[model samples]
Target: MALIGRILFVALFLGSGFAHITQAEAMGGYAASKGVPQAKLATFASGVLIVIGALMVLLGIWLDLGALLLVIFLLPTAFLMHAFWKETDPQAKQLEMIQFQKDLALAGGALLIFALYSGYGDNLGITITGPLF
Candidate 1:
């Protein structure tokens, strides 16, 4: 159950990170629409961070650092990209709010990971560094 949960947890970041890498242009355009400067670079950087962070946390190596990266990505993203307040349309606002809430939840999970295992990864028996394959 724990292994499954771990896989399910990192799956979100890995999937989205893959999309961000493959569809960087589209993602960057979306970021630009959200008023992010250097949108392309920002998008790419975020993709890398998400992938690396997810990998670290998933493998149980540097879990705290990985969670921190996700937190860094999540905060600004929740505020800027999913600015529900900026949406005037009721439906759109609802959608943005949902996204924002999801991001917030994910951030909370990241923080929890940090709280649970910030300094013990190297000595912990449950985690390994990097991918198993």
Candidate 2:
């Protein structure tokens, strides 16, 4: 069940990670609109981070660190990209709000995964490198 949960959790990031890279130019434009500095580079780098982090978590290799990486990615993204409070347009605000909430939830999930692995990793299931503290 834990293994299945891990897989289901990472499924969200796996495709998104690749999309971030492939759509860096487009994503960069969006990021730029959100005032992200060096948008293209940041987008590409984030893609790399997501890919590596998702893979690590999925494989149970240093799961805590991988989950931390996701948390790192998620928090800033939630604030920067989905600043719904700053949106004047009702529709835009609603959309951003949804995204913001979603990121926050995902971040929470990642944190929970981090805590689980950090505390009781060995008891979970199969892992390539286990949880490297």
Candidate 3:
């Protein structure tokens, strides 16, 4: 059970991180479309943050730090990309708000995981006995 949970956590984080890296250009364009200042910079920063976050998550060394970084990175993304100046159409605005809330939830989850288990240990266990004398 624990192993499965750990694997799920790692997979989730790794996938999210990879998305940022793989879609940096698209992300940048989207940011620019949203009227964000320095869209290119935002895109590059996203890629870097995602890569670092993915590494930490996969390596399980300093995952807390990675998760925290993810939270920081995602907060603005959630707001600027999904929340800010919602669509005029009520339905569209509601949809955007829903997406924004989802992103916020994801960010909060990452933060919680980081805070709870950052450096204590992996969510899994691997033990080996000492050689017999």
lDDT for model 2 comes to 0.93
What's model 2's TM-score? Answer: 0.97
State in Å the error of residue 119, model 2. Answer: 0.5
**How close is each model in CA RMSD to the real structure?**
3.6, 0.8, 6.1
Cα lDDT tens digits for candidate 1, 1-133: 4445557888999999888888889999999999999998889889999999998888777777788889999999999999999999999999999999999999999887776665444444357763222
Better of 1 and 2 by TM-score: 2
* Candidate 3 lDDT tens digits, 8-127: 655755666676667767777888988888887777777678668656654555666766777887788788888635688888788888879987887877776575564334534321
Off by over 4 Å in 1: 119-125, 129-133
lDDT of candidate 2 over 1-133, digit per residue (tens): 8888989999989898998999999999999999999999999999999999999898989999999999999999999999999999999999999999999999999999999898998588777776877
TM-score of each: 0.89, 0.97, 0.74
Candidate 1 or 3, higher lDDT? 1
Error of 3 at 49 (Å): 0.1
Give candidate 3 regions above 4 Å deviation.
1-3, 10-13, 118-133
